[model samples]
Target chain A: METKGYLDMDLLRFTTAGSVDDGKSTLIGRLMYDTKSIFEDQLEAIERSSEKRGDETVNLALLTDGLKAEREQGITIDVAYRYFATPKRKFIIADTPGHIQYTRNMVTGASTANLAIILIDARNGIIEQTSRHTFIASMLGIKHIVVCVNKMDLVDFSEEVFSAIKKKYQEFSSTLNLADIQYIPISALKGDNVVDASKNMDWYTGKTLLQTLESVQIISDYNFEDARFPVQRVIRPQSAQYPDFRGFAGRVEGGVFRPGDSITVLPSGLTTKISKIYNADVELQEAYSPMSVCITLENNIDISRGDMLVKSDNLPNVEQEVELMVCWMNDKKMNPTGKYLLRHTTNEAKCVVKNIAYKMNINTLEKIVDNFEVEKNDIVKITLKSAKPLFFDSYKRNRGTGSVILVDEFSNETVGAGMIV
Target chain B: MSYNLNHLEQLEAEAIFIFREAVEQFENPVILFSGGKDSITLVHLAYKAFFPAKIPFPLLHIDTGHNFPETLIFRDELAKRYGVKLDVGYVQDSINRGTAVEEKGLNPSRNTLQSITLLEKLEEGKYDAAFGGGRRDEEKARAKERFFSHRDEFGQWDPKNQRPELWNLFNGKKAPGESFRVFPISNWTEMDVWQYIKKENIALPSIYFAHDRNIVNRGGVLLAESPYNTLLPGEKYEQMHIRYRTLGCMTITGAIFSDADNLDKVIEEVAAARSTERGNRADDKRSEAAMEDRKKQGYF
Candidate 1:
């Protein structure tokens, strides 16, 4: 369905990451300010804060980096989300940190992002931080990449420098598992090629940041062909108002769910029919991907949370062994023998790292063979065997069901993010 | 065409997703209901999220003895109506136990002290996760908060070290004694809430609509007359047509000068409002990052 006030178009969640002083915040602030999303009061506050900070001009970076320490240090410490809507599409910008220590935050921010905007300072071109952010974005399996060459103002908006940086980044990015990539040079500080076409850079003709964000084809982003629905909770009131109302409550992770369709609950291997689809009051004929609704079955079956409801034919792999690429997120060293709470779809079971295949050299895009030791922010390929069988396909096939997070038992922190290979 | 899912529907779906994520992740979860519009909306979404089945968890309210008599009544009625368990933590108990000290002044309020009672209650109940109707659009500090907000064992929120929330897949895993303050309606703005209330025909407290109340003008906000609040020197009480942008205690919760009594009117008024809804709340005006500062100390 088309969204209201969004040119009746779909919504997109994307992230921007780069090293410190790369203008990530400036780009986001430019987008919000140019699109008229930043309210008057918010602008006034920023102006006031800028004045208090003894700056003559407003610092656009102050918008996303909200923490006091971050503001003082002039770096993003944690991911800050900023929402803005254009006529074309609604956007949620995950402004992630560029520092090495906050790599886990970048991984977290990019996990759900459909697109990744990796910023490269035009003067410095592609550096170690750029490679790391790009690799992390690629490792997260983000389908689209928008390379923003920021601070073109400092480079006198030179096309040669832009093209050189673009070429260098393209060569480096070629090593990662990226589907689509686009590059644009802009001055986030001067508001060039952000919300409007930059007049200064006539040689480089490309859509503005907002235009790219809105027009980026995301209809194909979600896997609608493969049916996968993880029952989050069960709705059964047994009240006199709606007696005998039993429904499986959850969002459609992937695929379309229609009423009167044959479905099977995974692991249990029970067959049933989707008798009805419900979103609050109305009962619908069909409900598709990303829409949260409750589905009632014609045949009563034993299904609960951590169970999957999918099309009978397009079943997920129900095996104990899974080959995956995981980005370790904890400072505490990963223990291959340690028991991790593996959550895939809704099903969670104990899993152990069976083998460490290799770790990716982000800069080189080479797989370095290593022992099964993954430290913080290290992206490594591994084979995992869970205590219980998992029902899932490759992440490329279904981003919804194929992704997982490993929670450390001792700390209970989400220590690792994994994608099925 | 209404074919486009209304904002309410979108908000509802998002809340349901968050609710399910919390229930599935946390060991013991509770919805913090203050009988306010936001909390009311939260309970409504939580109910629909897991329909037919009883709400998976209980509803907790850290009550200050100084409350709008109506809020407590609404709290009990709602709990009975839904057949969900309700837990009430009292500020008076905390004050009596010397866990929290009561402030004495013309504008004294238990708003800040409620945190102590809340933390104690959460610890006593061993509740690992609490669903709060906290929207980022409500305040400056809240605007920067994560959907699955993490709080340390001391019930402190380190705004600097928040976990990055990516997609719909919420990672609710946290350290011991640390709880996740799940905000299902984090994206819904104040106008969106009123619109949803109007669309869903959700009943709110009587104080939400314009009513003639004996109020005193204090710092550009109308403070309702109550034993909880005293008339300070150079302040005189007078009847004023006022309505509440938010529902809290009679002391700290400020009344806005508005004639828009109905839900649709309220929506329109909110859509065109200048300052934030929390701007009138004096407790937040203490500092630029007062909310953040308080949130760091576990003040929900």
Candidate 2:
């Protein structure tokens, strides 16, 4: 956990996963309440609801679980998002339910997260749930992991207990290709080491959760080395003021785009020079990741939505066949011969599942290829062939351009999300 | 020429991109103009989206018949300046046709009835899509809303059955007679909108700025007095310096006591405010899922 300094306006998305009673919601609530992110009226409403339910203390878990049945059962059953901002950075917390039934929801939330927080109970440290979360985090390409040994107060804040659990998890994590892993001892029930440093834990030396969150470096997380721009829409302001104005409107997914840079529009193979960049009339010298801009070419070459603008020498692979790690979201099973909508970048094309290569065992990281069936919530390795060739990199290269989602045409619902392997 | 985009400018660019995409994707899309600051900002974004070209779509105003006269003035002036067509769907017409019944007695408002008229107008005009200025930061339910919201033939939105929007790829596929509701500024917060408005120097309705207005303090809320609001016996009206956090029917929209009279000051105030802006809208006070329930019924 880095707390060396502070910068302004940084953004980091992280996911929280735990089995049944790890106090994930309490940790999140404490973070929000201590940081003043919780409003007065919302607190009052929660207080009233808690009193009505005859609970002595306000149920902090109620803050995240908005569904009625979950509230009645006192358990989370789906992925609920909660947003809070410190002056330094904005945080989007995907509170994923711990139940095995909602594995799809957990995958959906953790897929886009930059970091994954795996909570372990002091009483039951490094159990099956811990392995399940750790495997999912690694599989989803979450590079950073923070293993918080929660409920330390129940174990009398024992240093031996924390060290034992930490050693075991470290051994398992070594097999994974995670970039950064941090261990912390905290009691979420008593608000220890969440927002503020715990007074009792003098044996541990690390920044608190809030401090770690605010100072964690994320600017380097995006792929800024490859220049890939997917054309979203064509901007033609054919008014008398700028009648001949023609620009390719889209967002820069990776790398930097500048004027005078020679670019080529993919799928059409039309080459052109960057004439100008406009974010609304004001010309920009350069634009980078996540910044939307309209680029004008020196030539009036044909370019439309779903087209890619990339450097000719460093272009993505244009392949009709793609292999991916697919997370099935819908209840229906994946049909090998069924046609589905494959959306990657801004391009949408029809695709068919060529084969189910293997299925992942959630608890144990084993590949099951013999009797493969992609049931709901099953994260499987599959091969797909699109009607048209898609220009894309592996999901590891650029999350924005490499990831894809499968939509069922019959129901018009996104049935599965995939990362190109 | 290349440009360096500031934070708000970057957000504006994203919004403009989404707006133009909606224009190309939908057959006949209309902008839902409420004359509020959010919608006012949307108008400016749409204008910039086409730059020298006229905005490619018309503006749709679901007039509740209880709106402030100032809002209507602002709406008309905006349409006239941009040379864009404005379509006003009146709730009174829905009531006249007995399609929507109005609530009576004091606190009489047409907020809920506006949905019926809006749906009828969309059906009549055969609008394939309607663009809104809604943001996720407004409420809990809104936080779950997709950028491209799909509506059934009955103009109802199903939150559970949303199309997964991934990496700027918006799927606008819908069944026949079904229309989509596109929100270009779905990711922006209230403070972000105000900051963008200040940075862009976008003109807005006067009610957004602080001014002397006759208001009644009822149930600890500063409710602006209007013809539609029938005051109760003990409620006393007084003049106060206040500004509206949002604009809707004057009967349902509440005012806040503030000294922030200009765009910069409003932005600063919004940044420092502890409560959500939609907290001022009395209609949401009805229940926890007020916005979600209304949206499920196609109330934009």
Candidate 3:
């Protein structure tokens, strides 16, 4: 009734990658059910549809397959978001397809995720799909990976099989830049080691999947050493009460900011002190990463949208030429000499592909420099020359200021996504 | 040291960020208001976003001419208090102008006609972006919607061909004639909305609170007896205490039996309720994919 405690919970965003039969939807359904997030009307509607399809059991996939074509094909065509909450944390799941064709979609889903869950079937241990998902997760800079060995009931909850799969996965992913990798044996269909402990596998003493999700250390996931704020808009309330109130409004992309902190404005190199930081009328002493606040400078300086505010001591690279790894998303082949719109942070610039260095072989983690052509679902390294200098950092250092999206001018479609190298 | 924001404060901040983005990118934008709690909350956020100055965008209300009287009163009062411009598009004008025709049945509702009126208004006003208060957690099909949903020249939505929206960087690029429907509170759920309303102390229409009214039962849904609603052969109007979970054309919207007259009681009822807020709408009961079909044809 009075859920006062729900207000204080922190938010956790995660991405899930699994094949069609990996019971990914079933696992999500169980999570919602166990947390009492699924309403009765929705459950009844899914049940009615399941009965019409002549399913032996309630098809949990029906809950997430929102599109008509997706339900007819019985496969996830794109990313679908699902929300649930435990008493400890609020979770947002970006459910993505594991098929090789939908690699772009998986990347799109994993772009904003702090953690990734790679579902593996117990029968097929450490397969190519597992490697492909892990490689993409690492490329996206996901710090946490949870390898869920699903359908353990089919293997009689054998500890040897679990250990073997875990060992093989570790050996394969030892080169990845992941900080935390965990293994959990689960049976989504039978509800084993998902939300509750499994009696069949008493040998496994680790926490359940939900327990791990709720207890993960995510506050340190953000970079708190460098302060970066990309000015989104200028809030000028030209009224009588505050005639000259000009506030720079934006969300803090990294680090912490406080009043009286000396800051440097990029591209113009103007320096000033933060006069005040306001979050809807309440003056905050400090603002950190992901907090949206309006800030006023001590002195009036020339600043506008598409500019960056950073600590004068620690600055980012301000350059006109940038090297990046891009994933082509559009069906049309990329034009080698084509000029497109590159949007990064709050700035948009006209950019052209300078050179195609190499294309990554996702399956083998090999770099092929012979091919210069870029097509759909192809990840390639390219150098770009922008019309104006962009303030950015490496994608590995901070995801907020390091990512860019390319838009086709003619079609106005987002055709490519790039991470600055 | 780092400080964490509460859930309500976080949602509020995210919504304000989206509002500022809409104003900065689009040449002409308007807020699609329905005098409901969600839109009211949006208006409040807009006020906070550009404080000391009026909201840069105008409020667009598609009037079906079959709404509750209290809703209209509240809409006018809110516009005056906030000093924001209000634009009303009438469905009856479309009907009289031969642009839209009424359905022939025992219970004919103007719910579907709002789409035509909305499109006509957008074309007439040359609005490049329209802000809606639609949330993803409201219905099944909406769960896949992006923050910036693209619309064709004809105002039709192609769900399969939507652009991939990643991170906070929304791709709002579009052709000249094509427009975008931006949802600021797309991530918020029903519970989140209620909690925000309580925390912000935003005013809502009186119809949301419990009151005595005349009602008639139709296919297990309690319909508020209004002038536009025609009773069936065996149905009769009876006095009952009820409140609306959602607001729309009076002919199609259903009221729930509740005793939650205050905000606290309403929150408790919402927390314990089993059905979704949209479960009581008679328009959605027309088909399983009613919302999806309507969304494709450019209905908010």
Candidate 4:
């Protein structure tokens, strides 16, 4: 509640993926309540709903089940975004359902997250759901992951059980590519090692979940090596006050750019020098990844939306045929023969699936090369050949420019998302 | 090597990016200004979004005829100051045309009718994108909304089929006769809005600050004494110094008893408040899925 102390605080956007019985909602409720973020009226509403439903105790899960269908079915059908703030940082939790059927929802939540919190029941160790969520997180290039071994109270806070789960998890996760993984033992229901350090687990000497969330090293998560600026709009204020001001309006996708930096316009290959960078009225000396600024170039090259600007020395791969791992989101089947609208950053083009490399067997991490039928929640490595060449980098190199989405041309629904290989 | 932005700055940048995206993506875009703090903050963000040039779009206000006089004054002055056209689609017009009927009850506020009028005007103007000031943290159903939410030809929002909004890539592509309701500040909370308002020193309507008004408490929800509301058998209006946490139709937007007369005090009070900002809104108390139902019918 103290604004003066930490008004200028960074934000951390993380996603929580857990099974039905993992107490994921309870864990979130505990965090919000302990942090004094659960408002009184909201708590009362939850209490009333719990009482009406004849729940033995206050049902914290009621707080997250937003839609009528979700509350009726007692499941999270969509991603629910919740916000909380500590004096140190502001947190945005993209709470997603963890059932196998809700993989699309989890993918939606994981896309924007800097970190992913995979909740594993202490008794169950590492299960299929765990690997699915973890694989999705790693596939999405989430740099940090926190594995909360929930329900430590049921295990009597035994360190051996925690060690076994950790061992099994580390063994299974060794096969996958994970950047950072921290295991914590906690009981979301009994409030152990969630907000404060666990008193029950004296042997475990790790920071509480809140501490980890607040102090996680996320500054290096951004791709600053390659400078990619996808021009979303061109600000041409042919006005009397400072006429002939043509600024390329865009959010810096990656790297740091300064005035006088020589940049190349994609597709056209025209070269220009940055004249100025403006964030609203104040002129910025330099702009980096994710900052929405208007940049002016010295050369008046014909540029519009869908055109990209990058450092001339460092260029991106401009290719018409691109291979990527596509995650099918909609119920409609992905048609390899039909053309779909492929959108990458500000660029939109028509593309058709050239070939399906293989399908990922989530449980075994095997490749199913024979099966090419892509259905809902299916992640397949496919090659798409667009009508126009796309300027992009690998998904690992730059998430902002490398990622793309496929939309159904007729239905206008975003059916698939992909990471450029 | 250090490139870090505070939460406010990050939220501002995100909002500005969204604004530019909507402007560039849609052929015709408009900002749905409700004269509330959220919409006012949205307008301020729009100004920062297209800095040297004026906002590329006009502002649309669905006037419910039951407005606070101060709100209309503030709304007109803001539009004039920004040098943008202010288009008002009156609910009374819808009523006159028999397209919308007024609710017959003790509290027959025109809050719900604004949606119909809004859809009519948007159809009339052929606007493809309507930017709203709705925040996810405000209501339960809104927590699941995407940045660029699509509406069908009937202006119906099918929550089950929302696009998967991943990363910073927002797909604003839609067919003809369909419009998108885009919320730039989807990640912002009530506290964040107030803090940004204070940090930016943005101007707000006088009703946001504490002032004496004739208010009637109906079922523990304080409703200002306006022509739209009729006094019950035993209910009577009493003078009270109050400030509003949100602005809506004066008949339904409940006022809280407070003395927070300035932005600093308001933010301080908000920080210490126990109840949620929307706890006082009587409209939401209609049903558990009130917001979801209204949103499905294209309520901004």
Candidate 5:
């Protein structure tokens, strides 16, 4: 493998979501093994574990079931991050658990993923888990989805079986707002069409699973129209050398910014001009989304943490009362008009539940209106009134500026993850 | 506009964002330094996170009292170069104070005993957050760790009861007595760390490069000779030109025989290497659940 120009390679982060026996772990194992990402020691360790468990063949699932309880029960309880790199792009797989009880873990994993791989067992076709995971993936603002029809070997690698599963999945996914969807048939255990092309199913001509992952166009995933920078800290060097240095430190959440751009600080409604944008001691000509840089405004203003810097005219909605679709994460059910802390970007406020709009029946994508009792792993749409106004857009507009996590006051556990409507 | 960041830039950007979040969330924070490459990379990112301004947090080293001599000098120089405070918590001090009992064995390692000293120092300093150089790819137990990992009042990690972290928005809220062990580079792998070190031209300890050291082979793992470890019968230190893959208490860390003395050669060696970096760690070799057990007891 050539190491030259390896520094110029980009990164792609995706997640895998499915039921317990959908061969998610085995698929990941095949990908890593084919790409030579699994080290010899790790394979040896898992081989030893497989033998100790009295398995006939090496259990690839043991690679991700890292926790003691998980290993004992032979199930993945939490999100296990796996890494691999092709010659073109590096990949980060947020392998989330797929049990219904673990839906919250799936939501957590999909929040930062650019794409989501939803596995389908060919024998079972599109099950409830297939739709439930798809709903969560689309709800979390993931634009790309790859439906991997796994276990083709179990189905005798029939072309009719693959097409039927794809058609039904497409009909079910029509309700979601996913941008791009692709289908591939493969058997994770038999290494069919995972890394290399499969000869077993020559009738279906398509890119392999690894090819789809490596060739996915993810450059247009981030929102680049509205410039939003929420200040996390104010860097001020008090020393004698360049004593008057004051810059706003933040990661650009959306759009682009350059020196002399007219910027407005949210909640304060103060306006200033960008004098310089410093990316850690080195000044840059332009800064875009996801780059952590310090911005120096022309006028010294009272801009502090929780203050957002955006384009003067292209402003986000500043509202005290907001509607959100939240995935309940904790066992402690949400109370009526419950007071919880809401964190958005760099700012946070004490927010009360104004109203519960509806709860989603994840399996059928139906709205349950009458019963408002929310439990863990339930997706509910609710309205919130915060202590202060939050500058934001709809979740579909920009994921970075449009997401919030609700923290329980007494327990301090992240109880709900929300996206603005 | 491309709106694209290379893998290195992307990792750097994510780490810097996390660093600033800790600065804004916690009242008092410190970087848990070990004079290793990971901590060294952490320090470099923190410096860039708050450029033009001095690093806001101090460096806290839980000294095992058995360290590479080169690491000691490098740690002091790094502290001075960054103009940050260096706070050392000595395991020997904990042992002398009777708070921690040292192990009595043929090959006694201070690795597990450092937890007692670490918790004591965190309590003594009343630090609300301790930034560590923990990467998920390093160990299996760490693979599912949260970026802002919470510790109880006793500084014990409850792996099963961790809060769900979503997106870049980290929930750092905690009770009054509880503290957090935050890992900014939890997503980076071992290869990413080495590549970043080379890309940024970051300085590391001399032990990381190829050097001649007197080491003894124990169960196929070569351990460098130090006063902290005693040799078994028929065991003698042999001169070998080897380099350390990881740095810890000199008694536990193992070395590999290689001639990769420079950055390019080191990256090349790491690329074609077959074993995990922590495969040589005696502490992890104790059991499959060793890292998890140690993490539960407040080990970094």
Candidate 6:
């Protein structure tokens, strides 16, 4: 294997959603095998286990269904993360189950992904689970969607089948906010059009799945127009050496920040100039989204965790009352008037659900105005009254600053995930 | 155009962010130091996270009383070099107090006893958060572990009931008497760890490099002959060149035959290696779900 681009390779995190028998694990296993990511020992272990279980073919699903219960039950209970890398890029696959009851797992997996791969069985074109997965991906602000129409071998590698499924999916997803969508007809079981172009289906002219993933333009996926930095910690070295060093440390959520840029600290509304941006000891002229750094300001303002810094010219909405589309994740039903802990970008506030506007029919993309009770797996738009004002934007405008998690105050469990409207 | 971090730098920043979060959230936190490459890399990251100022938390080493002498020396030297407090939880103490019983067999290892000592130390010290060097790619059971893994009052991990970790927002909340096991490098792989160590020039134990050592082959694994390891009948020691891929109690940790003595060679060897790092570990060879069973019992 070539090692020239090993040092400069970028990282891409993608999520996979598929029900049982969709060959999700097989596709992943094929990718690993083609990329030489699977070790000999792991392959041998899986082979031995597969033989013991009386599987005629080596069950690649056993490689991912790692837990005892999961292997015994033949289902993925939780999201299992798998890593593989080619010379071009390093990939992290958040393998999530596609069952309706595991919607929260999909959400968790897709939350940090750059792309979403929705697997569709060619035999069953555009099922309910396909729409459900696509809707959740769109809700999570994933821009790229790779619709893998798998099991093409069973469909005789027919172009009509692939095109039909693609057209149906495109029609349904035309209303979604997906930016880049691509279709690939693959046989995860037969190694066709996955890592290499298929010899069977010469009608497909586009790149293979691996080629598309390796060459996708993900650098511009982040929002670089509005600068937002939520301070996670205040670095103050109170020691004898350089006692006056006080820096606000945080990961840049959006846009570009540079030295001498006039910024406004939210909530306090204090304006200051950034003197230096340090990415771990080395001072750089500029920093952008997803890069964690500490910035030293011209003034020693009263700044701590939960306070956001934005460009003076560009500001976010500061308000105490906000509307959000929330996905209830806990088993307990959401109480409309109950208090919860609302955490957004390092800031935590006590909030209460003022009213449930409507619940979303995820499959049909319809709003049920009559149903007000928000149960598990229900996506509802509700109004929240927070104890303190929050700095935010719409989830569409900025995913980093516009997302929040609701923690049940009594149990301290995260019960709901919300995207600010 | 904006500046973007490469893979290693991105991983470093993420680990640092996690460390800062743990310090900000938990009142009492400690880093679990086993003097392995992963833990050594964690210490280096922690030191960088709060640079110029000492690490906010102390370093806790659950000594199994069967560790490589080089590992102990390196651990103490690292703690002193970083100017951080070091706390030792001895497995021998647990055994003497009758809190832990030793396994009666030819290959009895104190590896499992360290769990009891670690939990007892945590309860005694009232540590609310413990930093472990666990990576998701290490074992199957560890793949489902959260960055902020919650432990019940009895110090058990319920894999099915873990909190949904979304984006970088880790839910570290737990009930009273409960604590969290924070894995800052949970996303890093074994190859990534070695690359980071090579880039950062992090010091490790000499046992990691290939050297001539007396070993006995047991169950197709090379076990370093030590006073702790009792050789079975028909087993004889042989001198061979070997290096440890992982570090644990001397009895359970196995060394693989290799000649990758330096960082560059080690990286190349790792890239071309055919087995997972834990393939040679006897403890994991106990059963298919050995890691899971141990983790359910609160074994780090």
TM-score of each model, in listed order = 0.91, 0.94, 0.98, 0.98, 0.99, 0.99
Candidate 1's residue-wise lDDT over A179-276, tens digit each? 89999989888989988899999997788878889888776777777888888877777778888888888888778888878999987999989999
lDDT of 2 by residue, B51-158 (tens): 656788899999888889999998999999989999999999999999999898657778889899999999988999999998866776676667788899899987
* Residue B64, model 6, lDDT: 89
Q: Write the per-residue lDDT of candidate 3 for residues A100-130, one digit (tens) a residue.
A: 8888999999998989999999988878888
Q: In model 3, state the lDDT of residue A157.
A: 95
Model 1 per-residue lDDT tens digits across residues B169-234: 677877666787888988876656776777677888888889899999888878888887878789
Greater DockQ among 1 and 3 belongs to: 3
Best by TM-score: 5
Residue-level lDDT of model 6, residues A1-421, one tens digit each, is 3556677878899999998678898899898888888888889989989998999988878888889999898889999999988888888899999998898899999998999999999999898899999999999999899999999999999999999999898899999978899999999888899998999999999999999899887888889989999998888878898588898888888889999999999999999999999866778888887887889999989998999999999999999999999999999999989899999988999999998999998888899998788888899999999999999989888888999999998889999999998
Ten-residue stretch with the least lDDT total in model 6 chain A: A1-10
Clashing pairs in 4: none
lDDT of 3 at A159: 96
Please state the Cα-based DockQ of model 4 relative to the true two-chain complex: 0.81
Q: How far off is residue A209 in model 6, in Å?
A: 1.0
lDDT of 4 by residue, B1-300 (tens): 589888898999999999999998899999999999999999999999998899999999999999999999999999999999998999999999999999998778788899999999999988899999999999899999999999999888999888889888888878888889999999999999999998898999999999999999988888898888899999899999999999999888999999999988998899899999999988898888999999999899
TM-score, candidate 4, first chain: 0.99
Supply candidate 6's per-residue lDDT for B32.
Answer: 96
Question: What DockQ, on C-alphas, does every prediction get?
Answer: 0.36, 0.36, 0.64, 0.81, 0.81, 0.67
Clashes of each: 7, 6, 0, 0, 0, 0
lDDT of 5 by residue, B1-300 (tens): 577998889999999999999999999999999999999999999999999999998999999988998999999999999999999999999999999988887767888889999999999999999999999888889998989999999999999999998988999999998999999999888888999999889999989999899999988889888887799999999999999999987888889999999989898888888998998888897888999999999999
Which regions of candidate 2 are displaced past 4 Å?
A1-8, B1-14, B50-52
